[model samples]
Target: MTNILHITASIRGDESVSTGLGTALVEKLAAQSDAQVAKRDLDAETLPFVTAERFAANSAAAADRTPEQADLAAIADTLIAELQAAETLVISTPVYNFGPPASLKAWADLVARVGTTFKYTDTGPVGLLEGKKAYITAASGGTPVGSDMDFMSSWLRFFLGFLGIADVEVIAADGIMGADGEAKIKAAHQEVAKIAA
Candidate 1:
């Protein structure tokens, strides 16, 4: 069966627009593809921020790892396994000060282990996780997605691409703190419906 991984960063819980959009898309996609959905709420279950020791532990071979290293590497192991098992990924996030939240950043740091997620080549570093499709459901209060001020979407897209998830689609509700906020959100939901269709 196909697996769809939905990762949400917004702390807004029931009130998050990005999460709402992602939920709609995931429901539709799951029904259409008969896929099993795996939800990861970063806000509720925060990942560990990568430190030098944690990074070393993650890079070490499983067989060679000490008990302490094993404890440190466990989260990365689970996160990487989630990525490896999924055929589709959905990241729903709101712009926090023109960027992604600390929780999401921490998840990224943990999952991006060398020789696990990506590797170096004679040419350059190449992503190991291949042939996966990803979607971003982004909601920004004022920062416009795809604009210079919108570091969240661009950085997320680049980061995902670095993991060989190059096929990405962005669904955004930007400038939602503006006068046309409701209209923009409604429009984004409509877009989600059509995408699912």
Candidate 2:
């Protein structure tokens, strides 16, 4: 059976548009494939930020590592294991300040380890993780399509591609502000149906 990891990054819980859409997509994906889904609510169960010590530990040779370094390395190993175990990933992200939340970035920092998820090569950087597909539900306020506004999709695509997850599908919900909020949400749901189909 296929293993799918669903990560919800919004802190808004039931009221989150990104979460709602992501949940719906997960249901659709489940119906279409015989997949076992694992959910990680990052907002509720936040991941610890990487520290300088953790960085040092990550770069150390296995035999030359101290006890503390070993512990940190073990944590990183666990994170990598969780990612590697999945055949697919679904991320629910709310755009904050025209980008993803700091918490989401922290999760990325932990998982996007050099020599683990990716490596620097002579050609540039090559992804280590392979054979994974990702779906990103991105929501933003005050920034719809065709507007001279900043969006996080570009950065997200770059980072995910660097990690070797080349097949990413994005469902974006934008312009959730002021008088157009309700309309925009309805439109976003319509878009979701199309993408999910």
Candidate 3:
């Protein structure tokens, strides 16, 4: 069975346009592919921010880690395990201050561990998590999807690519506060249906 991981950063819950559309896409994929779904809601269950101690703990050898370090490493292990197990990933987030949410950033920091998700080589840093596909839902009130003012979508693509997830599709629900909001959402759903099929 295929495993799919859905990560959400919007705190608006049911009211979030990004997450709502992402859910529709995931449901469609599950229905068509018989995929098992795993959800990680950053709003409902916040991940701990990476600290100096946690960073050191992740880099140290398993046998040499202290109790506190072990505990810290365990948290990262759980997150990484989820990512590694999934063949596909769905990330939904609303643009906040021209960037991603803090919770998403924190999760990224934890998952980008050296010698774990990535490794340093003479050729440069190489990502370890290969053969994964990602779908990103980016919602904004006014910022256009590929406009110069929008940085979230580009950054997400680059970040996920760095971790070896290069096959990414971005669904943008932009100008959500404008008069044509409904049409925009409908168009996004149409795009989702096309991709999910």
Q: Against the true structure, what is each candidate's TM-score?
A: 0.98, 0.89, 0.96
Q: State, as a TM-score between 0 and 1, how close model 3 is to the true structure.
A: 0.96
**1-197 per-residue lDDT for model 3 (tens digits):** 89999999998999999998899989999998899999999888788988899999988877999998999999788888999999999999998878888989888998888888988899988888889999998799988977788888888888988898899999989998999998999899899999988
Predictions in order: lDDT: 0.93, 0.81, 0.90
Clashes per candidate (backbone, < 3 Å): 0, 0, 0
Worst 10 residues of 2 by lDDT: 143-152
| Top TM-score model | 1
Summing lDDT over every window of 10 consecutive residues in candidate 1, give the lowest-scoring window: 108-117
lDDT of 3 at 92: 94
lDDT for model 2, please. Answer: 0.81
Candidate 2 Cα misplacement greater than 4 A, ranges:
61-64, 145-148
RMSD for each of the candidates:
0.8, 2.1, 1.0
Q: Which parts of model 1 have CA positions greater than 4 angstroms off?
A: none
For candidate 1, report its TM-score.
Answer: 0.98
